[model samples]
Target: MSTVGRPPGRGTDEPVGDLVSRASQQISALVREEMRLARAEMTQKGKRFGMGGGLFGGAGLIGFLAAQASAAAVIAALALLLPVWASALITAALLAAVAAAMAAAGRRQVAEAGTPAPQQAIDSVKADVTEIKEATHR
Candidate 1:
């Protein structure tokens, strides 16, 4: 009942079309798994970045409080040499200038940090796509 040259797949067991369909399904599953892996990797990096930023913010807050206390001490010392109001105003002005400079520097640094997308994952996915396209073309 089997053909002379062509395999019995067309008549028995799984046909060639079914095998092709299965291969496609497996490829799709592989792609989904790769996506999941990429997502997990990105999430891990995001968490680490968030934690670092939070720690920096907390340290900055503590430093600000310390600086305020130090400014008060400096003003009190200066008051012994000049009128209290003049000493306080001078201290306040100096502190304000320093704070402004620091704020500008911080802003510039943050702007330079740029976006936090998963670039490696994106590149890998792009390579995979290119490979798939080449294979399909062949």
Candidate 2:
């Protein structure tokens, strides 16, 4: 079929080679456009994530300062009834106890977590392989 001088249309008879070439080019263009769109979206999301992370860091610093102020207030309150050195020592002891308790709890949690390997997935894959082998034998 001749497609010469005919404007491209669905009804126009065209060579198979020309149609395949056009389809290939269209697919390539479509993929490139999709990649470009994905890159742009990721870039925008990355910027937002960075800004959010920075804000969270700032908030964390402020929270740390607040905690320090609170600790100082506790020491000052104790100092009203006791000597300054004694009050500071008591505060330090209390903080140390809290730290020890937290560390112990963290260690317990880590122990409870067991190994980091994906045991369930490994077992599932093993089961699948066994099933496949059994089927092949059958």
Candidate 3:
């Protein structure tokens, strides 16, 4: 019975040069496959980063709204005992603090990401180098 995946030549006793050339071809194929895997991995990482950041931003938005409402409620509660200006000032400060905190967290996360641009650029250069090597020797 013939094996479906094996080429007939794979079963042959071939010349050493033929084996070497075939090995080179296989190496090239392996590199191509590795490049593909890396691309896929980076894409998945980017997707996860986006999804996580989006979720975080969404939560932050909800929290911001809740914070503002709660601050207003606190101000109203305090208005009974405090001057109008003092109550408004305290609530405004609380809201500003919350906004600043969220902004800082977002900025830090964006900085940590530092963009996928560098990773993709490096992979492209590696692939180009591989191609050039094959071309030069041929």
Best by TM-score: 2
Model 2 scores a TM of 0.84
Candidate 3 runs further than 4 Å off: 1-13, 90-138
Instruction: Give the best candidate by lDDT.
Output: 2
Question: Residue-wise lDDT of candidate 1 within 1-138, one digit each (tens)?
Answer: 648787654555677888899899999999999999999999999999999999999999999999889989999999999999999999989978988999999999988886678778999999999999999999
Instruction: List the candidate 1 regions with Cα displacement exceeding 4 Å.
Output: 1-14, 96-138
RMSD, one per candidate, in order: 12.0, 3.7, 11.7
lDDT of 3 by residue, 1-138 (tens): 565787765755568898899999999999999999999999999999999999999999999999778878889887988987799898888779988999999999999998768898899999999999999999
Candidate 2 segments whose C-alpha is farther than 4 A from its true place = 1-11, 130-138
lDDT of 1 at 42: 97
TM-score computed on alpha carbons, candidate 1? 0.54
| Candidate order, TM-score descending | 2, 1, 3
Count: clashes, candidate 3: 0
lDDT per residue (tens digit) for residues 1-138 in model 2: 776777667555568888899999999999999999999999999999999999999999999999899889999999999998999999999999999999999999999998899989999999999999999999
